[model samples]
Target: MTAEHYFSAEPATPDQRGEIAFNVAGRDYRMTVASGVFSAGRLDPGTAVLLRKGDLPDAGTAGTFLDLGCGYGPIACVLASEAPRAVVHAVDVNSRARELTALNAEALGLAGRVRVAAPGEVPDDVSFDQIWSNPPTHVGKAELRALMERWLPRLAPGGVAWLVINRHLGGDSLHAWLVERGWQVERIASQKGFRVLRVAGKTD
Candidate 1:
């Protein structure tokens, strides 16, 4: 079997596609999944926990949001659906993941609100009111820290970031690391061995 990383710029695996159905916030989602993307088989467990435990926006919420490392658009779609007035940027390193997110957003009539893009494609001037992520911890500590360092500073003033990490995957250490870097980190929930962290900029 070929070892494939979901963060690969281009997955060498054949695009064997399928569908996954999940429910979040009383709404059901059916999205396209394929080989080479993260959690192509189902809604990822950490992601599922994040959605269930994190404070999701409502229909009246209005602002720019970021779905960092969006796999097949589950978090992106949910954000767009829950916050009708918000614009969601779904970003991923994998081209295949971006394609699937676009496809799913279009299928759900959220194409106008959900902007799918590669990490670098997001404009540097854009800032997020809220950032949601189930980061690629498999990428190693340095790479993961780099990813957070690259994006966390882009949070708008008073903005918050929601993240879910597997406990065994350095979740506690990550919380400590973020605090050490001056961000206020809170472990909001722990379920199924996953830690749901709510992070925000420190106030003066």
Candidate 2:
């Protein structure tokens, strides 16, 4: 198998199924996973940090949320459960990831609330009330920046995004870059060498 890269549009690793369990917001979840998807073996550390550090939506939260680069739908499932009135779009480029996400959502009884779609399949006109991602940082600076540029602008007015990145992997530089672009970026928390950023819509 080619050296695995989660950002690869088509991962070459032979699919091998497994399961992972994580607790968040007082709930425990056991989700299915397989090779070729991001963190197929377990919930990734950056994602774990993001979920732990960022503000999860309240029970009364409404409107649509975007789980960008969702792997096996952990974030999406959590969001759906926390905000039952809201719709969640779980977007990923990897087909295996999408399939696994769908399966996990169904297993969690959240299939109706979580919509799994390929990145390009998200409706063009839908804006998100919140966006969450432990983005694919290994995609390189240019691609990573482009990915943010493409998605951040789609946030609804007054919306925000939560992201986590390894501190050694340009997290500080990315904070500066977003600030320069007029976004209000806050380093809400740093743990396990990961930086959790909360990004608000541009005011200027």
- Best candidate according to TM-score: 1
Per-candidate local distance difference test: 0.95, 0.90
Best by lDDT: 1
Per-residue error (Å), model 1, residue 87: 0.2
Q: Which digits, one per residue and each the tens of the lDDT, describe model 1 over residues 97-193?
A: 9999999999999999999999989999999999999999988899999999999999999999999999999899999999999999999999999
Candidate 2 Cα outliers beyond 4 Å, as residue runs: 1-4
* Model 2, span 94-174: residue lDDT tens: 888889889999998999989999988998999999999988888778988999999999999989999998999989999
Model 1 per-residue lDDT at 142: 97
Give the TM-score comparing model 2 with the true structure, all chains together.
0.96
Tell me which residue pairs clash in candidate 2: none
Q: Work out how many backbone clashes candidate 1 has.
A: 0
